[model samples]
Target: MFKAKNVIRIGKGANAVLARPLSGIPLAIWAFSLTFALALGSTAAQQTPPPNPHSPPPTSVTHQMYLDMKLGTLNIHGDNAVVEALVLQRDIPITYDYVATLMRTPNAFGEGPACIVCHSSNDQLKSYRGLNLSSCEGILLGATEAPANPIVIKGEPFQSHLIQRIRNNRMPLGTPFFAPVDTDSILAVKDWINAGALNDENFTTKVLPLFVDPVAFGSETACTECHKSFRDPPSFNEVNLTSYDAIMTGAFSKTRKKQNLPGLPIVVPSNAEASPLYQRLTTSRMPPGTDPGSPADHPNTLLLMRWIEQGASCD
Candidate 1:
């Protein structure tokens, strides 16, 4: 398991300044007699570099100083001007490996893909309360502050919406999402949530591997082999799902024209329902052949549906 270290804070002070290696030397040389003479001369001349000649004179000394500082004064303020720097170090948890292992095994629920059983369009479209497993990041992040309602993030395993849904008898009730998630997985998710659900490099690298199929299925192979021509745009109306990037970007469309739908967008992050490819697969209307059967008749189609529902990802 990966562990993160505490944040390091460096406070600003004279010591901090002195610790920094000095750069170029100042042009002016100060001596006791020279400084005394210069001070006396300045007082007699009533001249103090014309209070920064480049800057506009202030209406008053205090106001002038304030405006000059605001306008980019070279002078630094007192101790209050000190800056504090903080560095955070994070580690990716090994729970992602466990998730990958679980995904590879047959779902106990006798579903297509164990991962998809809990994640795809079918789950999200349900009328009752349930966690949308489409995007792990989305579920972890929860909703942003909006006008109508604010989504909350659960810092602990028991408090998380995903955890609560899994525990509930209503959801994944008969599904794998309801399946027993290991304590390590729960803790990993909890740690991620507590850490602000950041999509940092480490988190992404770990999470992505869990979402991709360990073994390539027939549909992925068949689609890649048989559908070479449709891979590019203008030939198949500019909708290409030949690659993961294309799928996430919503490059596939049967109508050859783009249309807007409610819920999640196909190309937008966490917008699986709005994705046309998912819609076609879940609806059992894909392969674009002359005769397409119901979704129930196609196992490959089912797999694709499950993959999408589980969070369509390249990893």
Candidate 2:
């Protein structure tokens, strides 16, 4: 460990500012960071090169390895076609819909019954983390619902918390100890996020139905269970998720400032990970009495992201 040292100024006047290192930086750590910064001229991700379709998926197919492999070799000229081809190369097409299928499949990884056998059950709140993997919308909301830390950070898979948890063996959490999922599945998902985590179909087809489905939130009641004023609710806190019109015109009233509760946005078009409403369902905060959701949970946070990514459109 590099011990903290007071930085010394070597030059007089304004040149001292240019010559000296910042005070709190540890020399070794600073040097290491600068070595890469100087070599790359920017964080490696500043160049969002699509994966080379012909290149094999890394034997260790996490985002970090992907970056290092590409950057070390200076192969940074990939394009949309390459991204499409690379992520689509697996036995399966990686998209929100496929993830939902895996969520519902019986004994998906030989660890236990399908994830939804438990996560989607009404009783999930009693034993599990309260994430409802029942639909694309719920999945996009993510498990933790932590706003600042999104489950899927599009175009930057390594930064996504979902990838972090899976690589660390912390998800698919259930009986049989949430063993590592298949390597192919993990790689496919990572590449999908790195490629902007697009939806297989339109938002209306994949996500809008979820807004009206009661069971999607692990509750018999739908989002309409609360906030009935789709057009004009009485309070600033309540938002209308009842219709496409209401949802698009999120918080129709500017009277939100006067309300006692904090007026957070329900949906942010093309950015579901940042939307508090999506975060609410993913963290299992809705339907009453579950962990307060944040946009941070991984397993429960991609479908809605795709919806938002697709412009949060109705049609």
Candidate 3:
């Protein structure tokens, strides 16, 4: 526990200056100073409650979702290919430990490496989202936002939100645009869930760094600055520009309804003019609060447009 101290002593001179009219300072500067002070004061006045250690971690499969991606795509990688191939050929069931090992290993396709980022007990998002994916049991608990549907529904992969979200590239929240879970990986999850998402797997944990696709990811990962993911009711949550795949996945738009058509493509390979991503940035409809088509954003936009013009290769 800590105690507050009166650190500032206002002398008569300082008081006199504050009490005096704003004749000396410019109106713009004065107004800016006042606004800054009020904002700071308001921030200081509000207090965030301390994290409760007793609060159990969220039990959603959000983190396990990443693990599922890793485990599901074992056939594509070199080392795991032997065992996975054998398992597939013999029609032998994939075991929990084998899947766990695959999860611990880094995926070649870059779905993700681990579940600790947002699912750990100490993770802030766990508390906010009421979902934890730190363990097999935790993942089975489902997201707080959608408790009715288990994140992984044993024997029914299609009914599982975990599969649906990953298939749609909506889970893992803030991944890069070109990094959707590949078809093979999605199928792996589907198979695993159908086999029952078991927890008996013994995994020797090792650190596998996340895979970054330089061509597609570039520098942007955060998109909430220009887009929203959470809606008032969780169901209304829309797709964000988190990755190249996400961009390609396309989002539902207000215009889609008015025009009575399906959503528009954000990126159309070899067609920058047709790309909503290029047009929106160039036309200045995004970065919501910025000057429309601000020059500051044009260079990146141009590079992206050119990439699209070159057929938007994922490689």
**Quick one: ranking by lDDT, best first?**
2, 3, 1
Best of the candidates, lDDT: 2
In order, candidate lDDTs are 0.30, 0.41, 0.34
Cα lDDT over the full model 3: 0.34
lDDT string for model 1 (1-315, tens) is 111242111223321111111011111211222232222233332323335557655675345434433344423322112111100011112233333333334421123344334443223355122333344443444433321111123234322333222222211112222233333433343344345444666446543232232222212222223322333443332443344444333433433333653222234334333233322222221111212212221222223323333443335
* lDDT tens readout by residue for model 2, 149-215: 3355555553444444333222211112322333433333334334443454434454556546665
Worst 10 residues of 3 by lDDT: 202-211
TM-score of each: 0.19, 0.26, 0.27
Off by over 4 Å in 3: 1-84, 101-113, 121-128, 146-148, 170-315
**Is 1 or 3 the stronger prediction by TM-score?**
3
- lDDT tens string, model 3, 255-310? 45458865445556545433443333222122223322223322222222232233
Residue 229, candidate 2: Cα error in Å is 1.9
TM-score of 3: 0.27
lDDT of 3 at 238: 45
How far does residue 35 in candidate 3 sit from its true spot (Å)?
71
**Better lDDT candidate (2, 3):** 2
Task: Give the TM-score comparing model 2 with the true structure, all chains together.
Answer: 0.26
